[model samples]
Target: MVEEQEKRRSSEDEIDLIELTRSIWAGRLFIAKVTSVFIIIGLIIAFTSPVEYEATCKLLPESQEAQMPSLGGLAGLAGLAGVDLSSMGGSSGVMTPQLYPEIVNSLPFILEVMNDTIYFERQDIHATSFNYFKNIVKPSVMGYILKYTIGLPGLIFSNKPEDIISTKDDLSFYRISKEDWRLIESFKERIILEIDSETGIVEVMVEMPDPYAAAQIAKKIELMVTGAVVEYKTGKSLKNLEFILEAHDESKRKYESVQYQLARSTDRNRNVNSATAQIELKKLEYEFNLAYEVYKGLSSQVEQAKIKLKEETPVFTVLEPVRIPGDKSKPKRAVILIVLMVMGCMIGTIILFCKFILVGKRGRSF
Candidate 1:
């Protein structure tokens, strides 16, 4: 009797599943209509969206410093064996690759970038990146729709067009024009800077309407960022070199003066006052020796400065150079259609569920 009851329960569950399947099938026409409407919307968006070309470049910055064993570690190990090595290895507080993006995004850097000349082949337009970003490119259909719809309030309350373009007396690099500021913001949005933690590799990406422009900008940024980093790294060394050069020059001049004075004194007392002449010669020789030492010391320091300049220089290895993208990077129509279809299915399911529940409740109440 128990086995028969279990079998009956299984059969009943199967019947319920079949009923559910049939109910879902009944809504097939509704689902198809909703899906078709979404597909049409996707088509409109896909065709109307602006085509953006992306340029990509990869970089490997100096990670060798971390890999090289420090002299400090060797010094510490010596201490463990009863020798003092506390002063062996000392590292400077140089900015790491992680802060590279921050440096690039700084005001001065952006201003420099704005001054760069960009030539667009398709448009035959030659202008500064500032103007290229500001006036040449047209907004996509969706971008336009959002401006009048979602962004309407901001536009309505914003500054006048004339004020944004005004350059009467406000030509300071620090205080950029309103239109230029907006362009900078947009330019920032289109640039991608990604650094991998494990590999210490940097990937830069640039996207623009024109393929040539995208690639050109990407290459330009790569060179600019590397140069900025190298300059930062070697700044102290360069200043030190300059100081050494000036000190050496001054020391040499003093040495020359002492030599001339010593010669004049020796010639004047060549045959008279032997004791006074000896004392005077000794004093002049001491002065000459001191100056000579300073000059020689500075000569060594200058060589050391050159070495420091080389050591502090940052190495940026280009693993993947910038390439012009052949295809559009935005307005993925397949994704749009799929998302809309899923949304429609969910709405349809909810409606059918509520209808069935209400009808069943009415039947039971009756």
Candidate 2:
């Protein structure tokens, strides 16, 4: 009885060890199967993903003082009004030129970008293509659905427009506006504009799927923005100069009339009593001289305004030009293949392990 009991205990120990090993090794087949599924999906994704190309353009912003002379002008004007302009010229306040970059990235600028279909389409195609591969191609179940139903049909029948200009003519105004805004926002996020603190230069960078399009849009936008800046500044300067000219003309007429009167009085007076009259004449002469000086000053100011207006306009020099890229930036195939292969192996192994566990249990029970 003691030997039989010992044998039964040994048998129980063996069973426990086997169960422990099986449980650990169990569903490895499932893991392998899942991994295999992932690998295959990854491979398909890598293969089908579209290629993207990038283009970049660089530029520098204009001089800070030229861009925002209002603060300086107002300071000078305040001094003339007998107010202490220096105190009001707050150094703590934000600089006006710093706000320019924000204006460039503003909604209006973004809207302008949307109005151009070429920019919008390039952004959309790149984004949508990547999303499709990542979400639809990677999941095992989704992979099956895509392969059996969507994949082949999409390759053959997908009618995604090649570029934005081609699609815009077909889209209604509302549709165009909506799609364009979306693309603009996306492009804005991708594009960068920076001002160098030390040199006060502006750097602009735009990244797009089409290298040429990216370069083209960057150049076009820079020119548009520069033209706008020039137009606005020039208009203000011209108006100021017009007023200055009018004031100068009025002062000149006054000065000339006074000088003529003074000249006639000096010629006619020849007696000792002419001394008192001469003093009066000298006083009027002084007034005339003062008016003449003011007119001269204003004329000089008009010339200065013209120069400032010209200099303030932003100018761009292309540092880099976009060229046709030989390679696309998208659809990394090797990564996708490795991921899918691992998934497939995990899935297949899990199935094999489940069968092994169930069969071994049934034989032992029988």
Candidate 3:
């Protein structure tokens, strides 16, 4: 009896599926009209959207070994001569690949990048990034609509006179008004940077309304990032170099003065034959020798500090240089059309099913 009941239930299920299919087939014309309307709307959206061009570049950071120079031999020799040379040796700090993203996202670095001048091909003019974003670049049709509609509340709350006046008075480097912050946020969205941890490769992409502008910004950002990295890595070494240079100058002056004194004393005492004069000559000679050795050691340290600074400066090799993209990166019309059409079909099918169910319920009531 159970097997017979199961067979009957399966038959009823198959019948329902057939009825659903027949109902959909009968409503094919309605579905087609809905799809056609969606297609037209999709075409309008695709053509009216703002066009964007993308440019990308890849960089490989040169890895450096942070080994300090071996000063054991020199230290041993200096020790025998009763001079200390241990304070001159130092190791440079290493910057890892992970910090590249942080450096790029830093406020100061971003501000510097925005301050760069770039040429816009569409307008045939040169302008800084801040000016271009603020005054030159116009909003798209959809952007204007949404700004007044969904974003209207934010605009109302953010535009107080006190807020603007306070930000304007602050002349600090990091202080920015709401409008400037909006521009910065927009600019940040256009530029993307990523670093691969294992290979130490960096990829940067920039998107803009003009192809030339996109490529130009990409190249500029690449150079800025490299400069920032070099400056950070060599900061300590540069300071050390400066200090060594100052010490070196002072040591040379002292050594020269002592040598002069020794020379004058020898000339004055050439005719004297007293034990006191001889002892005084020996003391002056010893002072001059000690000054000469200190000067020599400082001179060596100056050279080493310069070499270390050069070594710490990192080199970035461009694997893929930025190029002007020939095609627009957005407004994929074909994809938009297909997705809209599929959505229309689903909506039409649901409507037809609802209608069929309501009619069947009325027939059962009768």
lDDT, candidate 2, 215-241, per-residue tens: 656666667666666565456655766
Candidate 2 runs further than 4 Å off:
1-33, 60-101, 117-184, 187-203, 224-291, 303-326, 335-366
- List, residue by residue over 29-122, the lDDT tens digit for candidate 3: 9999988888888887788788899999999987764223344555565567554454544445667778777877777777777888888898
Off-target runs (Cα >4 Å) in candidate 1 are 1-20, 64-91, 160-183, 260-283, 342-351, 354-366
* Model 1 lowest lDDT segment of ten: 82-91
Give the alpha carbon lDDT tens digit for every residue of 77-192 in model 1. Answer: 44454433332232253777788789767766766666788878668887777777667777778889987999788767755444432235656435455546767887788878
**In terms of lDDT, which candidate is stronger, 1 or 2?**
1
Better of 1 and 3 by TM-score: 3
TM-score of 2: 0.46
User: Which ten-residue region of model 3 has the weakest summed lDDT?
Assistant: 159-168
What lDDT would candidate 1 get against the real structure?
0.75
